[model samples]
Target: MDQPRGVESAPVQQLLNLLVDRLDSAEQRGSAGVKSIALGERTWPALYMAHRESEKENLWEHIIELSCWGWLVVKPEVATRSRSGYADSPRVTVANILEVRKAVGRSTRIKSAVERWREAVREGLHGTDEVKAAVSEFCIDMPDRSMAEVVERLNVLPSLVGKELLLREVSSQLFWGMSKVLDKRQGLVAAVLGVDECPFPESPIQLQVFLPESGYHGVLFIENLMCFERAIRSKSSAFDGLALVYASGYKGGAQRLRTHDGCSLFYSTRGGFRQDLRASFEAWLFSKDVIPAFFWGDLDWSGMRILSVMRTTFLELAAWEPGYCQMLAALIGGNGHAPEAADKQGQKALDFSGCFYADTYLLPALHSYKKFVDQEQIRF
Candidate 1:
């Protein structure tokens, strides 16, 4: 009963996957055929792999599920809820992390590496080198593709930015400026979706969504698909929107706004914007008279980056005003952690440094923690 009735949580499984690696690495020399580890209560090795507050919160509820799989053992005599005391030579193994998982509760997500990769390729993510690299580098050690860890590794790859190699159909220098810098483990990779000299449309483009028929104050662009879909359906003021666009995985869907009418504002769900998509945003902002545009994203470098992109160098954007700013300041002032951007696309921390003038004091304090504060958790 400890393991829930259906699918396991992605975050919990991710944690278990990481802990298994640690357990495997720390195995003793003269042990039996069984390879396992010992975990002390109130210690980090027993909890989330990430030492940050945000990650801690994610894996907090699955202690029982892990116990059920024998992946985690708790002393019946000790406070189980506390995840306290010590775990003796436990039976937990790498198999616990790699084993087939049941469809717990509402989740029917498949965690198999082969199956997932096949699905990914079918979904058009088969960019030869990327798919190969993801398999060889990430899954080679452990074929746990469903693990959130693998997903994060893939997200940061230049492939996620949807950039493709350009054939030398023209002078390479002319196409250089079209590239965007993407942060990677080795450093940064300059990504170019298409060479300017190539035929008609160089790359597949997702159009900016607009509800020209809907009456409203402004346009809201959300990073999360669920949230974007919910915005138009709900009449609640908290999620109310005149119109909305889904900026899927930082691929800003806000297309040419000049064709559409301006409202009170234009904003995003998460932080940061790429150069390839900035021109339309610029035109959207300065079209006629300056209309109000707002950006409400997670409280992290990435979110701030999106905000910086929205604010741009020419125009300044206010924090969800005195209210959002005050809330953000309170979180940062308290040392809210800024977890390294899981899939950071920008090469520099201050990718949009020009907007720093408005909130210079806020960045240093926020950046120090290097943690992420999800906007969905806080009640606005």
Candidate 2:
């Protein structure tokens, strides 16, 4: 005797597979209909009508279960009903089915739109009138209360309300209730010198110096904001004799330093370095013979990259604490940690074992299973 076939049988499996393939193809083409199943002419027309009218072909389990149980027979009552009624013509049923499909499609589109809006919010672009106008224009057909309710429900700032309105107008709540979890990290460094400000150009290169009453010049530049803030707050006696100037992301702080008698300011530009400014900066660095200049930044790849650029300007420069193991240990004590090895590209560019400069030191220290020390990790 042959074994009984369950839902897992080869023929049933093949049929299910065929149904899935057909459903996927229809979905991809934005249509609904099954043309692959083999049955009689009468059965085929009925099945096609059922598939098209139901528009639930993607729910293959229900359709396959009904077909396998031979429950797909067209009823007499259904046939008697007019084409405009519940058990109507294939075209009429298809219209209803398409109504459901359209609902689902609209929902998906709304979700995508909400995601875009949330992204704009995270970028601090949500508060603009342009975004509000766009939302108002897009959500015109949405029910007043339904769309307004969604906008109100979002905990985001008022600027994000327009995005919510636009999404609701399109009947999409896909990215709804998700605006609260965006990252808003600002990467620029901020420093406040004791002197008013320095004359830093609006360029990416910022060389700051701090001069104390003792006439010792503490020259440094930073790329990390929190680290810079902490450094200024913790006035080290080592910096007592130095004339310090800071290269900050803002022009006001640099400009204030210009008013001080002996202090100079170097501004940062987004376009790296300008030749004339670079020459003037180098001249300043080499001008004072007895003073030892220090450079400090984060232990990350970007910090190291900046250190590499600074080397071109300062020949006698050395890495401050957090850049080297000894200085880091002295500043932070035994709790100081070294950064992980440089990433593969950094390792190749800076063979850690071969050099001791600011940029090359991190690669070797990291390769030796040491962790990179963040400037923020050091206690004043």
Candidate 3:
């Protein structure tokens, strides 16, 4: 695309110069390409101020002209808007670097970093079928990120890291400053690197399960640690045939049971004995004859939310009447603390948890009292 006539104003020329400078810097750093570079305070503060000052005089006519010329890509497609609506600043990036360079009379071609990164990726494609598939579809598209650094990380995958390592450990070894580079594209990283069986770092939150010695009848998910410890210590007759599982604030990992790796939860943490116990627990959890499930947590909105979330995995999960009844009695007697007192001011008031026990008895009590009682308050 050629530069349009009558759009060669000073501001427009200055903006074009800035784009060329950014492109040259990107080339030096081996970036794939820039995208969505905000033409605001962050990227071009000086230009932004100039635009603001010139607003009353030129009224962004230069921006419109450059955008109309196809030399710059303005967000919101402002080409269709009337002049009155162009008051606010829109994000802008070079639509075509070659055209911008030509317009600025600096048409020197530089080899793209994306092509180099792609070649490197292809060269390192000697892994399994899964790796090959992921690599073939891998894209070098993150804006302002170095493709060379990514290539270096990809190259180190074969020798630097071991199988079944945590994602954080790999990230730390890669030393990509605060960014969990491996964590983002897990499938690609896992396949290309053979770091773990599952693409993601296994859940660090372990489910502290106590399988009943007697025949299994049901399961109770305990939310807090103290309550879980208490349940194990008590060994009450009420929990005789029920398997007790400590929820451990699990929200996402529990949902993975419905996926291809139902047993991956067991394989998450290291150790053979621990793995065996988790396997047994997983098997019993997903048995054909659905076991009755119940949840016992704090009489607060967060607990209710956890129950509602975990219910997706444990279909029959509901509020445990025995525990909630105790909590409810405490709340009604004004034995509970206010939301602010308990640092629960941020907790949202949940009106439901998809359980008769919760909907019928628990939610109403919490809403009515606006108080919370921890599960640990109730002994057994």
Candidate 4:
């Protein structure tokens, strides 16, 4: 468990960091370039990966340490070889980048999980049989997005997957949102071809989940849970014809589903947008151009960023201007503002030209006021 000093050295870290991106690119493109990282002594990858102070002798030592940790088996004897190793160098890649740290056990654990998940998916299994596979999807299929997070949270994944359909829930927005036709299967027999219940609420949602769900003509996403609960409470009147959902805070993401939705509604934050649900949400926009989707969040720098990020996906994502006006009026003396920190966060201060909210209103007013207006100001 302790990292060897040399292995922990800047040189080794630089080397690995360079390789990580390359490996990811290679894997995504289905290229053979990842088999071995070709690093010449004068090349940028090698120089960037090499430490400022490491000499040739010390460099080889680091390689040995990395090899000892199973990152790559090194062949340090040749000059034609890359800084990490030559094309035909004895140092062959022995494992994945994720496997480098826990060369002994974590690798095996992750490997087993991936294998189990592969088998489970193949067998159309659910529950414990399906949990590892879902996590494995994060670990493998969506590697760039979730591998590190999944690896860091692997121990908790099993229990988390027990009651929550983490993967499938994320699948629509994260993996299947771009779908024209639903291709996945859910539960024992349900394939996501039509109406289903939205899964954002921790409890049962009485509303249906497909696009243009019956009476709901539009969808509204709130950032906070209380707001979502409040919206849901308005089911019979004002909120009718609106599939209201909570964007699940800054940590919102796509759900992986065994069965995918035909048309999925996407909810995301600055942190979750394309990284989490951009594609799926975009697909929804592409499929249903008529449905109006609005994202309402607090009036702050982050809120602006959230709006900006959401706009990239749903160009129609507009400010709840009427509600925003009401929110400001209800404020003390109609004197409005965002947080102090938000005011100083210059990006928030910049006049967001061509903002969907009539360009000159709402956001500019908030910027001028320099104060926070919680969305909860408007009750259900």
Best by TM-score: 3
RMSD of 1: 18.8
Point out the higher-scoring one by lDDT: 2 or 4: 4
By the TM-score metric, which is better: model 1 or model 3?
3
User: Residue by residue across 1-380, what tens digits does model 1's lDDT show?
Assistant: 54442225565554454454454434323233444434433234435345665544334435555566555554442434543222322233334443433222212332445555444433433245554444433221234334333333333444334334322211122233322211121111221222222221122324344443323345455555555555545556654433455555433422222223212233343322444334445455446335444455566666666666554421534444423464466576663443544454342455343444336644664556555555654443
Candidate 4 stretches greater than 4 Å from native: 1-214, 235-237, 250-289, 331-347
lDDT for model 2: 0.39
In angstroms, the error of model 3 at 204 is 6.4
Error of 4 at 122 (Å): 37
Q: For each candidate, what is the lDDT? A: 0.42, 0.39, 0.67, 0.48
- lDDT (10s digit) by residue, model 4, range 207-229: 11222223345667677677766
lDDT of 2 by residue, 253-276 (tens): 232232333244443332224555
Q: Comparing 1 and 2 by lDDT, which wins?
A: 1
Quick one: RMSD of model 4?
14.6
Candidate 3 error regions (>4 Å): 1-151, 158-169, 176-205, 251-253, 257-282, 286-289
Best candidate per lDDT, number? 3
Per-residue error at 287 for model 3, in Å?
A: 4.4
Residue 374, model 2: lDDT of 56
